[model samples]
Target: MRNVSINQLDDTPRKVVALGTDYSHGHLLPFHTHRRAQLLYGATGVMQVRTSDGNWVVPPQRAVWIPPGVAHEVLMLGVSTRSLYIEPGAVDLGQRCQVISVSPLMRHLLMEAVAAPLMYDRVGRDGALFDLLLHELTRSEVLPLHIPMPAEGKLLSLCQTFLNKPNAHQSPQYWAEQIHISLRTFNRLFRQQTGLSFRQWRQQACVVLALARLAEGEAVTRIALDFGYESPAAFSTMFRRVLGQAPSVWLEAAK
Candidate 1:
């Protein structure tokens, strides 16, 4: 396979590469990881990034950060898109493991930043813009599209289903029994496979459910109860922790 040339750098230290492509239809990027952090965005249409921790759906305003060495893959959605791939080490703005929004200004700057010649020196306008872009990117909001997984493939699938049915009161051990495994076995398999405790995996499920419910126009209070939260305030507290904003505020902003 040909490595897509991102960018080229020369002189006075490390280099950064930015590569992009306009692709259409059902494009699938196989599972892989790299030394450079990847900031993937869609100028148009929707995209999804699948990492071991979860599946993050990319809205038009959002982008996914695949930190260095995280094995993952891409699934394209909607129409063709201009996928801007920033080279690693060029910018340390994006954090690991989150799907942040691409601000209007940041998006515009990145459109230009990616095109900046690799060999451009640090003193150039491109370098200055690149650095600024990094700062804005870090300040951007992370869209809610991540779905954490359990280690067992079945467990992971069940997690997705749980998100779709957050109101289900049945315990995972109940599921284990259905899957013909003891409760202990089910929990052990999930921990080994998903690299997270069962409780952590469930937390991810709750977040996904919250996002989906929000996307579907469900009220937070109802969603909280539906997700088995003790109260709306508790649910809102959890949401703020995971998404860095309260539900009422974020939902209004979403509008």
Candidate 2:
């Protein structure tokens, strides 16, 4: 159903419900939960999804799979979304949130699904399309766009602060000192809490944030300098390392 709230159709006796909506730049969907699992696809622009455990950045033409009842908030930038709310028993993509690569066939399926009848025929073409969609979702590539948040109070606070103004050059010792822990202990604790080493986590954070800025049309050179990179080339190196493509190439593909 185009532009309709899921609450109004949550009880529909169907395995999947497709909805499409468009959001202006900088739109925010506050923390909310859904009775059914959600495959939120961004046909245009980017999406930043935040849950209790972490944050995920969904670039244009990708999607984020949100498990049933997982409370989360979404910040949409110039996004037009096609959402599939599926019954929990209908498919099991994963237990955790995932940013997945959307293939061209799957993209067309989503577009068609969103335009199908709200109570589409279970024994007809609409049903066949949705069935293929579920299969495609199972085969979709999971992207490394998630930054797991720490649960420890002090460390979590420090991590949150860093996200506000991320810098590639921020030393691990700085974070350690801010939390009044020895550098060694901090390293161990950081990995234990977030399942990522300090260096890896910092780079992931920078790339995710840089993506949001890039979507807003910020120059790569400025973003690189803001993140303390010596040059745009240096920043692009890190970006390519993490995402497997230079910023310009990725952005062009996204367009």
Candidate 3:
């Protein structure tokens, strides 16, 4: 689905432009760039965004702040999204994409902003609402919901393979053997290429893949088993450790 409607979006002369749109399950947006920074949040379901820098997953109650001029594509996992387009320099949300948590109040504000006129008054109640929205965005807490891929072709290929079938049971030694490298050399290369140790990267890959599977209506038990977790509790512990909530609870919030 063409949810963002960039053709209809006119960011000029407006500090903040909001749009509320829905996407069907598995909808994909081709790589594109926006002149304005985008705060793309899902009211329900999950969003997977891939940029040159890394891949980010935005779950429910969270949003990804994509800087202006960055080429990115989003895969909507059955989500209804609320998007805010801010003119370049209107907000200093850094120079890269980062996932940020959304407060209950901020969620309400976004809904209200999208319902307001395209060109909201800058001196009236609408102006104050948008102002508050911007403030909340600036203070939003960043979340660890990204997986960085290595630039090296060999390492990138290996990383992509692991991401496709992430399993918690795999050890660094196993991965090193898969790449036909000594354990010591594998450790050095992984750090140099991905900026993360093999263990760290595996866990991150598992978490990222877990988010996608959960969004597709898979049960936590099945997902845990698929990811090589010994038990549902073990999987929930890892999920909670990374996301600060159990998988079931997180899925409930997304709904």
Between candidates 1 and 3, name the one with more favorable TM-score. 3
Q: Write the per-residue lDDT of candidate 2 for residues 192-247, one digit (tens) a residue.
A: 99999999999999998898889779999999999999999999999999999999
* Sort order, TM-score high to low: 2, 3, 1
lDDT of each: 0.65, 0.93, 0.85
Q: Write the per-residue lDDT of candidate 1 for residues 129-226, one digit (tens) a residue.
A: 76777678668766556665654566667776776676435576777976789988988887777666666666655765566456546788888898
lDDT sort, best first: 2, 3, 1
Give the top-scoring candidate (TM-score): 2
CA deviation > 4 Å runs, candidate 1? 1-4, 7-15, 79-96, 160-176, 179-255
1-255 per-residue lDDT for model 3 (tens digits) = 134576587644678888889999889998999888899999888899998877888877789999999999999987888998888888888998999989889999998888888666899999999999999998898887889888767678877787777778878788779879899998999888778887777777778788878877888899889889999999889888878888888777765
Per-candidate clashes come to: 4, 0, 0
TM-score of predicted structure 3: 0.92
Instruction: Write out the backbone clash pairs for model 3.
Output: none
Worst 10 residues of 2 by lDDT: 158-167
Better of 2 and 3 by TM-score: 2
